[model samples]
Target: MQKLKIAIITLITLLSAKTSLAQQYMKFSWKDLNIDYSAFAYLIDSENVIVRINSTQSGVLKLAEAAGKLRVHPGYSSKARVLEIGIGEVIYSKDNKMSGSFPAFRLFQENYDPVTNKVSGRSYVAQATKIAQKGYLSSRPDVKVQVYNKLSDVQQNVNAAAYFLKEEAYYKQFAKPSSPATNNNTSTNNNSGNKPAASQAATPVTVHLVLVGDTKDASIGESVKSDLIKMRSLFQNTMSVNKNIKFNIKEISGDQLISTNVENTVKSLTVGSNDAIILYYSGHGSNPKGSNSDFPTAAMIKSSYKLENMGNLVSNRNPRLAIVIGDLCNSVPRTRTALPDQPLMRSAPAQHDPARVAQLLIKAKGKIVSTSSSYDEYSYSLGNNGAFTNSFVDALTSAINSHSNMSATWDAVLKQSYKEAYNKTRDIVNKTGTKGQNGFYRGSVAYN
Candidate 1:
């Protein structure tokens, strides 16, 4: 309370002292400053823009600014609600509404109004946080009503004409002509979580485990694919213990896989109903059109094999599920150069979509594609195995061991795997300050 009062005094002083709109900052408290939630832009420089606003809990996060919508990172914040509007850090009024360096957050509120009433707004905030976290709150029945409520707050805020004006000049710094690539929370594998029920008749399930990588051109497979390969045995062994699942895993590698045979291998697969095909590619990839390009265009490719349509090919067989994950670069820059260590994975192969190439390998509705890094970022490796692939295996294995009905709980496997991979990789990146590889699930985000 003391701090809030002090801030109040400071803001009043600052407001009175400064007559220019270009002031560095205006410190204020939540108590008296009833300014409804508005868009804010922090200009780090002419090129780098940081978009932010306060939420109920996660504070201000680094928002991906584009169009008129702030995308992703809504679940992450620094725990501070202050906007620190200065040094190009801005929020402005335009035409009578909020428009500026940042877009008004897609504040979907239900069950209450936030701007008019503080208590109801708090409830809305709690629900928004829950939605941002998704399935993690499945067990929290108490909050379900608010969380599941429709996206009405945004409309409500607009209808009441309670919206703030947008500062167009500052907003132009971050807004893009094209819509930005959406945040991907897609997870590839969920085969580990569910076990077919005992009462269910024994049905042979066909699963194809395709390991795509380069072992010859500085074989990343030695480090990236080995543990994943070893874990395959554990996966099969665990699956085999069940008399119901008759599974077969075929790993294709060497110079042959690196050649034209890559496409042939995927195109030749045979899958039956209730079948699943898992494609794990540990190599380099790129987003040719740029990171802002749609996900299908960011194909992660290599010299050894044609993996672009792997997911689609598998899905064509009408398998029950398709899992495609790429441990490689999914660059966002217009001009993406391949890492110096890689030869075949060119520097942003033009018109290539690594997600489709690497992740959407099958293009089936039942598929999940997760990648290690977004465009313009590099992936990390410890010894030989990739940080993403290693964490992915550990998460899935743990989920599998804890559950038995794999058929009924594939999504559970995906959730845990996605969470583990993201957290493990995020930890390393945060600690090392590494600039590439923050893995994300392309389907629905399973991580809390």
Candidate 2:
């Protein structure tokens, strides 16, 4: 009798665990220009959710009745509370009146049916996963309410079906412990923090310098190869002074020849650890269109910027300083459609990308981001190379008329460089035509 009783208890415990695991929960979806909670709800409802439009006064009351009848187990209703939304909040009710009472019960913890429309059940799971991956859960419990509500409407029977779906996605991306694959890849990234004893013994702070120029479209056009020379020569001079510090000057390779090489160049420079990096780019540039909707508006480079592969380089976490000199024409813009929040524009090819430069700057810790234009300005080339490049050379050679800390020295030089580049580009464009003038922009930003 005792053995039989123990067996029964174990069976019951196992069954309870299974039941708990199967419970359903709400899945949160962010509002985009294309879709939101209403659409998400339709997708969660077993893909058979019917579109219910509240066009008449009677229809809303019917919705209230339907909503009120739902029960997780017994009399519990799954309606949402009347809470303040951004800007303002509207009280949802079965009756359209300012004072008269009507059915206003909230949905079950897992139900989030909108008052106006019911969504079909195809887009909800996808939206929920997206919101969770962005790391916003700690701040928004309402998202939890909204998600589980959708699950109850799905008829999944489990209270946590939607929540599990989102959890599965998050675990896939971040669950793995550190492994050999991650380590080997780290080595290839040349991002090692360890330095030779000699290197460590030298400078208190080292600057990572990334110098790129001669963009694919305007590579001195082959005609100037022999007759012309780099106007600014100090790019190599200043960094050579410190043997302890290293500079990874990127070489043009294969397809990278056509795009912004900042990503690869930084990868080479950041190998091991240092103090700071001075990143500079010169070549052709153009504006990326801003998005008309929620989707990112991409930057359309005259040449490719290879923004996507930049992930490896932008992951740096060390304290560093950066000096970005963009000598290419049309490198800056007025506004962008793609905000940093959305990573949608990563699809564009290398030559026309806008996010590469901005993304890299964002990842560098203790950094500053300088550009070559006002929101409406353009940058331009000087004599042989671009004006920004010439100024960079002059600054390093004289250390901006000082031998003190490299940071202050570089800052002074960049200021002068921006002024010179702006004036020179503008004058040249004025003489050429308005079309040329539109392409002339300048900026000197210090990143630390």
- Name the TM-score of candidate 2: 0.35
* lDDT tens per residue, model 1, 298-379: 2233442223455566566676677776666554322122222211110110111112111112222366666666544556
Best by lDDT: 1
Q: Which one wins on TM-score?
A: 1
What are the candidates' C-alpha RMSDs?
23.1, 24.8
- List model 2 lDDT by residue over 1-448, tens digit each: 1111000000000112112322233333333233233211222111011111111242332111011112222232224221101100111223533222221212223333444223322221122223335543223323222433332344443222211111222112223333466444446522244322332233434445554444333333211110111221122222332234343444342234444455545655544353555544444444444522111111324445522122224436343443434443332332211111110011111121111222122223443344444333344433223445444444443342223233333345556556654544554433224422221212233433
Off by over 4 Å in 1: 1-200, 219-221, 289-308, 332-365, 403-415, 422-436, 444-448
The local distance difference test score of model 1 is 0.38
Deviation in angstroms for 204 in model 1?
1.5
True lDDT of residue 276, candidate 2:
53
List runs of model 2 lying over 4 Å from the truth.
Answer: 1-207, 215-235, 253-255, 258-265, 268-270, 288-303, 306-319, 331-365, 400-410, 428-448
What TM-score would every model get versus the actual structure?
Answer: 0.42, 0.35
